[model samples]
Target: MPRDADATKERILAAATAEFATHGYAGGRVERIASQAKSNVRMIYAYYGGKSSLFDATVAEALRRMAENVPPRPDDLAEWAGDVFDHHQRFPDVLRLSMWAQLERPEATAEPSEAYRDKTLAVATADASPLSPVDVLVFVYAIAQAWQLSPAGLTGLEEATDESETVAARRRSVVIAVERMLQKGP
Candidate 1:
């Protein structure tokens, strides 16, 4: 693809990511994505095939970025959990997109990406804990995202005072929880 086409595609992906994260696949509108991207509906169809295809691409790209930004650390699962928590805080849209995919694309959930596969293998090889590798990975991920996915009313307690301090405290809690889980095993 030419440079202009590449840039346009990126813009479309960004717009689509935000749209789908907010509205989910069924409710996401290609027209709005097009408008947000400063491109037209025809281009989105031409570039991504259709709305469904675009949504798939958007979700894939978001996951790819997350894997790149927050690759697993098998040796230090607690720090890894902290990194994941930080990633979610910095890019809340990624978590939203993930949740949207889980709700709307159940079939797609079965296939693990290479990044996830590598992480699982690393975790298994590095840790001799009783917990299965998959379970460890899932547990760490759940703990990392717990704050972000919590009810707004619950989170409001953290945000009631100094935002940075509360967020840092939450992050510390995530790290400590993961550390304890690793130490205790399952």
Candidate 2:
């Protein structure tokens, strides 16, 4: 039986994704990623060059997954916001990976890629508003991820009381906020 190079690469990426999510770029160890993937560190180095390159590939894959799974819905921004929230809730690893990239390698963060641009452009409403559709989407995304990324300011007290309730309340707030913003008509 022959080993599949693509399958091995996919396994490596999946392992690296989990490692990076758990430890960030500075803290994550390629050895651990290789061990977990049941592959060798040399294979990772050969396939990805090094930790930094691996991180970049992981980030790119995460962004691609997000763009594919949570595309914009201009006809119903509120629904889109909900969908984003759901996606984040389900895939917190993506957010964690992104946070690591932003915090550890701020300069590396670049403008939105075309994968995101087309979707954002489609969501742009035709109105003379100060905020662009992308801006609105960013705000809505922030709202949806408030609890996940950082909630000390958003619901520190409520979170202390009941974590589940706090999360539910925040998710509701995200939907309502996006709905109101969309209803404001551009």
Candidate 3:
């Protein structure tokens, strides 16, 4: 792509990401994203094809950022969990957007979702653990996402707070529960 064109596409995606994160897929509007991007609706369509495509880009970018923040490492589950929670805390709106997309159009991106999931599972399998590969993945992601999704009341933190003591306490509980389950192996 040409320099200006590439820059425009990046800006459009950045705008769409923030917009969707704030409003979710149902509430995200191309018009609003375009306005925020300093581009027109036509430009968004021209660059990204359409709203669904833009959503895909937004998710991909979010995931990429996530991967950057916390690449999988077997011995670092605690740190990894912290990174995941921090990412969600810093970008809670993105998580909300993802939940809406997951609910609304799961089939639309099942392939990528499964691929991403499998890769994560592979990371868990690298651990010299007692849990089955599937169980490990399920437990790890379950804990991380649950912690990310925990309400402020459950966490006893400001809704916008990130990785508070309460939140970390919740995570520790998850980790202890999973460790016990692994030790007891089904």
Count of backbone clashes, every candidate in sequence:
0, 0, 0
Q: Give the TM-score of candidate 3.
A: 0.76
Off by over 4 Å in 2: 107-112, 125-130, 152-156, 159-168
Pairs with backbone N, CA or C atoms under 3 Å apart (clashes), candidate 1: none
TM-scores for every candidate against the unseen true structure: 0.93, 0.86, 0.76
Per-residue accuracy of model 1 over 14-116 as CA lDDT, tens digit each: 9998999899999999999999999999999999999888888888888888889998898898899999999999999989988988999854444447879
Candidate 2 lDDT over 1-186, as tens digits, reads 997889888999899889998999999999999998899999999999998988888888888888889887777677777788888888889889889989986543453477667766776654422468678767877877766877566555553646567656667888898777666443
Candidate 1 wrongly placed segments (more than 4 Å): 1-3, 108-112
Model 1 is weakest, by summed lDDT over 10 consecutive residues, at 106-115
RMSD of each: 2.2, 2.8, 3.9
Best candidate, TM-score-wise?
1
The reply for model 3, stretches above 4 Å from the true place, is: 1-3, 108-121, 124-127, 157-186
| Residues 2-114, model 3: lDDT tens digits | 45987888889888878887777778899999998888999888877899888877777766666666565556554555556666767776677677668765544453465
Q: What is the lDDT of residue 22 in candidate 1?
A: 94
TM-score of 2: 0.86
| Alpha carbon lDDT at 133, candidate 1 | 91
Worst 10 residues of 3 by lDDT: 106-115
